[model samples]
Target: MTVFLCDGECEYSYDDLLRHLNQDNYFPLLKTHHLFSYFGNLVKALTNDVPLVLLDSDLSPAELDGVDESLVNQSIPLSVKRLPSMGEVIEALVHSTSEITMFTSGTTGQPKKVVHSIQTLTRSVRRGEKYNNQIWAYAYNPTHMAGLQVFFQAFENLNTLINVFNRTRSEIFNLIKKHSITHISATPTFYRLLLPYERAYSSVIRLTLGGEKSDGHLYNVIRQIFPSAQINNVYASTEAGSLFAAKGENFQIPASIHDMFQVVDDELLIHRSLLGQSDSFRFDGDYYHSGDLIEWINREEGVFKFKSRKNELINVGGYKVNPGEVENVLNAIKGIRQSLVFGKANSVLGNILCAEVQLEEGVRLSELEIRRILKDSLQDFKIPRRIRFVESFSLTRTGKLKRL
Candidate 1:
């Protein structure tokens, strides 16, 4: 829409809406296209729906053709279209965080939308960009909270926002080599995937990992790949955002938290991060009865290491899904008796949801039917990519679904 030529010393394009954003005139960051997917969704949630049609340069019609194809409902058109340049994306996000919408992981239940003020969103960017420089390779997205932070941080810095969508590890490395990318933040799974091609380039300056564990599985390869680069681990969630983080190769555990945490049953309780708690989350006193099940890597150090998730939330291609969301839809089928949702370990995404469904005696149904129902109702991102039928499910002593 409004493009800032971004050639005169500032290597970024800003929208006319930015005239209202700031006086400092610089935010250095780069974000991938998935963030725009979130933006497309965000605008819809504000209006109480998702756009039937999506415009994105990163996705092909084949990728989105199966989205919503009902004829009568075709009237309920949702389009996914691709736009060129970062300036256009910014124009679409003209309103600040206060005007933005946030949806939870819905791990315990249905995802809830929290209307964050543009100020809240701004606070997140301000706090995130506070200690760190605004420059980046622009790898994050805006669909999730973390990605949004990356987008705004770069906008505030007036740094180059490089785009290389659908590129493989080698292609990305080549871009990094050509652009001299300095900072990059992605999931541990992303880093592990990058390891195979790490030899292609050695210019990485800083590496940040989250969205999954970063122990030896990830850190080991990182050490071997970028011996000179720094590595950091972060612990946070969609609702709680990021709370505790450790920078550099040798991360010393944190001491007593200065903010949000509880010791219920010897486990910590985390509240949703104050969107304004600066870029890095600061623990505040509000004790949100958190739902996380994790332990520490402590012999005595406060540094925490993630063991596993207690919730049914799965991350697929950076999209969060609640198994129950899909299970509920499947269970509604006339012949379906019950269902179970679990994430199978994935190499690219940290974990992806797979469903096991049971049908009534002498009755059979196709997974495609169940999937169509689920995909139609929930975000396509939330639909399970894999489906399996089970004769029956095993229950635990506590009366919970057991892994097959």
Candidate 2:
């Protein structure tokens, strides 16, 4: 009973997906299918290739050329399927080969190839009748980790998925209304951008936020929009598959993994079990130090809040400032819709903090007035020296702010 909507126009059913996957060949680079369809074929491919690479449909020819030659030489479209024995394919997938290569979201830096086994990717995924019969929205790029997570959830629970990638905020809202999408997992930036689009969110039963830090301001707005939906902010990375989830704004370490992580000098560290067996990251004894900084809310109770990435810290004449902290404060303002804070090069102050703000419809506030409000909460160096109004903020493929 699986149903999929592509680009808000085309509709495909479970039988159609099975027919396509049964006919597709594994030797060639498969032409990308609509996000959901792509995952269907990905499951088929896993049983054959020792390592398979998928190129996103949105990538340009030049971008396509940048991928490994080994993958590109054998490319085939999703429509060109080669029939194979299902039992054999499943057996091959489970025991013969397990590695699947995927690219990073490229929010922090250039997108790089990351290899993760199917088992590692699905290690933390939950399955239950509670998730069945739900209509999930696939909002992330299909090739990205978050997108894969959404697909895995639907696949494991036999839930319907609607592809909402490459659509405008207004269009996405319409799709949600049309399909009655019950569950959605996306970055905080995606939710913020979607806030202004007026629509009926009563159909959304669960709303999960990840890929970026969530703040109280964003949480309150989502609460107003999807009043009946259960809202949670999840913490996961490309390197660390689904880690922790918090019901409210602040991320709290769950009891199951409280001893699995430690805060060393405000930076979060993870035990090796949480990470894929990859040599790319440095591990000390059994812990891989996560570069994210945290502020303890209740250290004894395993409650803490994410501050900012260590690299995202701006040094203004030796005074360190976290842009996320400033952005969070700015977002709390009544009329402010979204804000981005970054360091601007300055001769005197090594780097001066600057902010770009997007305001709510018809809302007008002066930079001085904004600063006046910020002054009440933030210290002098932490305040952005320059503030400018903008229509929108640039987002990565996965809908996170493109910081780097």
Candidate 3:
């Protein structure tokens, strides 16, 4: 029988999943680093149609505002009739009425809860014989939206998942070869970290990037690493599941839901029907400001390109500069592995742009040289005033570069 998951030294089969589901009880608010246990609990709750709250393993009680600390990781007895097989359990989970509670990153303030049903969570998952027996490099924090997306996509198809999240560079490559990982769906930053491209991993057949805006330079590098792979990007969020799919940088909205979106002053507003229910979500009429700034490629056909987040724009001397635009320029430069651009408070400019750059191994780039190159491509105000060369960059839980 095909292994269900390969997490470190631990290997779990579909039989193990069945045994776990047949247990007398399951945790409703689980917080464990053990991926199998977490998944087992998740499956139990969904199959039994019991409400569940997903919490990051490292999350503290202070981080989660309203959750009772005493109840976390505590199990509730299950009296429902046990399923005879794993297939039956999966079927029950697919048609589950479970309301799953997940939290935002709380980048701006306290983490807010968003609730979603199994249908909304698995809307983008495509299951078929063509998708079966594929080995996936699980590269996401299992508590987050992207992680859940990948989990359902693989699990529903009974595909094998090899956990690679937070693994070292050498370890990740070793596991890829050992397991013949065929598909990888992660943030661009995760791919960027495997820089100074070594040998090609021909085993990878499909690569999906999401959680951050990626540039052409990253795509080019990914193509070289996974020559046989078909590269794509997914547009998903905590408030909503996957909505649009992109090849390079352009996202084409499905025509069936074309009337559900409205672009006002470059900010994309989404209809309430396309979103998960959340008390934290503030809607303007039937539309909610998505805070995503998009440029129309063909507004009539619902084709568009994501520019940047509205709140991510930095104001410098009465001018608004998108950090992603500058980072794209830096990333395109030869010998630069990755770049992070952000704003710093300044006495005169209110906010002065700054960048942290990670160069390819043995690469020597002066700060002045980078500034000179930027002058030709960017306006005076748009260019970062300060640039710092770094060996590594700080990453968020989702593997995206953390912006200060």
Candidate 4:
């Protein structure tokens, strides 16, 4: 296997990787080779009931102090290792049930711990010769659900994985070019940030966008960069592994799982069977409320589109406005690289729509021009009353927009 890092390349054969796994040492905390160590730990966990905790590699000392004590104690750090006499424990763990714990990105709020088993995590990933021999880029952190999916997909199919974690845009570009990466799965924010580099993407054969709404503007931008690649917008969550995939601008519910999902009072409800844990959300015997609002695109054809999170709805003078809708329109506008729309307090209006926009590098755009463009596409109430141009938006460790 070939692993590309910001500094240089590291190659390890299958046997070499196994030998490294068998060595008596703790895995590196934030190194690029953490990918290999993760698999190594996974192998050991499979044979024992030891749960794995993945901390954010970018966490500060203060942040690390805030982590749970049990998790911190159980966590596998860079210098620790299992004892050699634990063969019996490893055998028991391999045959016993164990869980993998991951923390949310906290893009919406405080990051929380989520638990999942190997079966639920890999249920939706496809494996076969069709996926083999392909080269994939490790854009997401291996700890996040999206990152785990990318790793498992490549591992199960015997494909090559090039580590690009913690790398700058220029470094990622060079790595992609060097390895001729064919598949990439990342959030829309990551893609938007990388667009300004304008690196050659002819080598990319497939693009998967998830963790955020995939609007038409992003689809168009990706198409321009990699014309021949297959672009797919995937709808998934840490709770729900992988639910649906859409090729076009809209996220259409697949017909095969039509009965597994439903829209009730504008909230999307997915069957409980698809979720890793169903206790946090409102779950009846069979379905779990997804907390996301959905709009019917074609009632007759069972087509629908994601509107926004039910909790994220902006109240504009008692008129509800979905920020995602406004952001979608803003993202489609020329020169706007990224945007965040939200509700701001107003004495007279109760609440008013506001937007913060980040333009492409070297591109100058004014608030009035953006407002004028919004006037043509969005309703007066839905348009942001206040628009501000910004240099860049804050992102969480998982590459999601950090909503304030």
Candidate 5:
């Protein structure tokens, strides 16, 4: 009689999950905000070997190129043997031949489709007795890659998931204490929103940050907030599922798959054999350029630290400025919760660095003050010329800070 999900006032038990799996039909293009229904459809599709496409509830069919608006959320018959228990469903999912189609967050352009198998999606999942009974704070859009990674990891272990994505800082903290949440896996932007740490939540035993680069300052603060937790980073993408786990500040490719990776001119390239099927992916030789620029900590050991995305570096007056590096400095400033740095087209310089900053609640600072703080940390061209204070940040479908 274990509970599967606790979302707001609604609670779903293992029995409820079983009942959903026994349904006569499943939606191939399910779009819903209700996590339970979304998860139910996902499970039903995978368990019954039904292929399905995951769509963000807020995304319009027009935004995606191939999706037919009329066919969305439409149910189709799926006849499969009934599973008496949740364990049976899990077993079926583990051996499923179903293909899952997911789209990119469309931060840079229109959403592109990538189809993945259950193996690639759950490659990093570790299942054992130690993984059981761990309560998770689900903190990403349920349809995205990172979200699906967290879901499969927890679902396979039959662990309880407490929906906390998009929840306010106060509400999240309250839930951590109320549920004694043991694990949290989310993006750096999601963790940044919880800054200006007020108190510790000792119950969080483990934390995993992915989908964005993290810094030592954020890691130090997270350690203080969750002193008992073991924090780590993961590398995942729309083109590839979770691939590397952090070894300190760097990531070391597992020795078994070591030959599958190569660094060419600082860009990490992945062997095509390791990636999901996607038409948008263009390969150079048999490898796909990951766009992630990295510096080797140890070339022999295949250990490296992420520098920044190849496309995210902004050129300002012949100087290349890394927005992530600048934003890390902004985030380290006192009373600043989160910051987004980007380039605005300029008549003179080609592009001028600009920033949007969100301050801690009840705190105020002038843009000049922020500039003065940046003067000490950054080079002249690297500092943002324009800074706008804001109440909140716009997030992508995957809960990352929206960028141009």
Candidate 6:
């Protein structure tokens, strides 16, 4: 279609969307931010046959510049239009299998275009029916993987997807209370941010954390706020796709549920998956090896406690430090709401742990206080060598804490 408005506004009718689908028009109007991804898929779709398109509101100026030029050169038949809500967007693309697309955050590296049919996109809709047809205060951008899942969830059940696209911490809190939000899926850092506004948005039914790791400490904090909510920590990749998710932190997938798991040398391997594009979901072994580290506390437990990500470990000094260990301590501090631990070069330690955190509003803490708090739970070597307070940390499209 020509224009698919995606500023979380404008609700078009079915007939109007149909006209766009058959001819060249627009349904769910997207913002300029989504134009880059839309252009990328549009370019690919022109080459082959791609039905669905999702445009995440991310990408650098260089990437965007490439898209703008490519569009002009290809002379792609597309334009932009304004739409009101998610309902109208679904109505237009509901009937067309080729018109549905899902956007991924590209954590492994470069973002690749993955297109899915309406049948594939809607496969997990009813599967997520626990949150079906209910009022959902969408906390994520409607452009990433989480956003696409929520979009399809609303489309399948016709739920009132309250478009809380760019709500601030204060604004999101107010909206949840005002709109009576029931289900939620955000990064662990986002949940930590809600602690300040906990009293306002405590009446949650379901809470899911993805794009980042979660420990017992963070899980307990969320449990305190959303007592009745079924909190979940999910593990899904772009190549592997999302099928079933764990109900809470440390929850493992049952073999009966998903036989795609295999552990070797303490590393998890998931080859057979049916989530992402068909090209990504193929025949040979059909596995996506998750480069995650794991250890078993006890064989009798029949499950493994999740550990550091293999690719994300920081090689500080001669010894290596896992960021998750430091992040756990940071989350437990009194004034610190959320923190990310990463390594930066140091002449002495080779590499030292550095922390960027957000302090609780109206609360002040010196670097010494921050270090002392970390010292209470973490080892001396693990404490941040340099501490910096930030208003907010970077986030991926799927609500993961970004290590910028």
Which candidate has the highest lDDT of all?
Answer: 5
Ranking of candidates on lDDT, top first: 5, 3, 2, 4, 6, 1
- Per residue, candidate 6 scores C-alpha lDDT tens digits across 1-404 of 22222223453333333343343333232334542234334323322334434545445534332134333223235443233433454454454435444434666665665555555444446534564546666666655656656655654565554555555667776667766777777767677777753453456788877767787777777787777788877665554445456655564565564466666767767755454553433343655557777776544434566787888888777777889988888777777788888899888878888999888889899988888777767777888889898988777666668875
Local accuracy by lDDT, each model: 0.49, 0.75, 0.90, 0.71, 0.91, 0.60
lDDT of 3 by residue, 1-404 (tens): 67999999999998898888888898878999999999998988999899999998888778887789899978888976489876787789999999999998776667889999999899899989999889999999998899999999999999999999999888999999999999999999999888767889999999999998888999998788889899999999999888889888899999889999998999999999989999889998999999999999998888888999999999999999999999999998989999999999999998999999999989999999999999889988988888999989888767788788
- TM-score of candidate 4 against the unseen true structure: 0.84
RMSD of each: 15.7, 3.5, 1.1, 4.7, 1.1, 5.9
Worst 10-residue lDDT window, candidate 1 = 22-31
Candidate 4 Cα lDDT to native: 0.71
Candidate 3 runs further than 4 Å off: none
Which structure is stronger by TM-score: 2 or 3? 3
- Write the number of the candidate with greater TM-score, choosing between 2 and 5: 5
The 10 consecutive residues of candidate 5 with the worst lDDT sum are 61-70
Candidate 1 vs candidate 6: the TM-score winner is 6
Q: After superposition, how far is residue 228 of candidate 1 from its true place, in Å?
A: 3.0
C-alpha TM-score for every candidate: 0.50, 0.88, 0.98, 0.84, 0.98, 0.76
Alpha-carbon runs more than 4 Å astray in model 1 = 1-12, 15-97, 105-111, 118-135, 164-166, 197-200, 248-259, 272-289, 297-302, 312-404
Model 4, range 1-404, lDDT digits (tens) per residue? 43322224555444544455455434223323355656656655544445566666565444443345444424353332343433342344335465776666666665666677777677667866687678888788677888878876776565677877657768878888888889988888888877753645799999998887768778878787776689988887788777777776567777787888878899989897777752345676688878888788886676777778888888888898888889889988877888999888898878888899998878888888888889999889998888988988877677778776
Reference-based TM-score, model 1: 0.50
* Candidate 3 CA-lDDT value: 0.90
lDDT of 1 by residue, 1-404 (tens): 32222222333234432332322221111122333323324433222222222222233234333233232112232332233444444444444222443344333443444444444444434433353433365544334555555555565444444553234567667667766666676654345345432363456667777654345434655666766678776554445455556763233334554444555554466645444232223344655544444555563565554444445457788876656556656655566656677788889788777888777667768878888778667887677778888765554211124543
Please, what are the lDDT tens digits per residue for candidate 5 over residues 1-404?
88899999999998898988888989999889999999999999898887989999998867867888888989988896699978888999999999999999888889999999999999999999999999999999999989999999999999999999999999999999999999999998888888888899999999999988888889988888999999999999988899989944789899999999989999999999889998899999999999999999899988999989999999899988889999999989988888999999998898999999999988988999999999999999998989998888888889988887
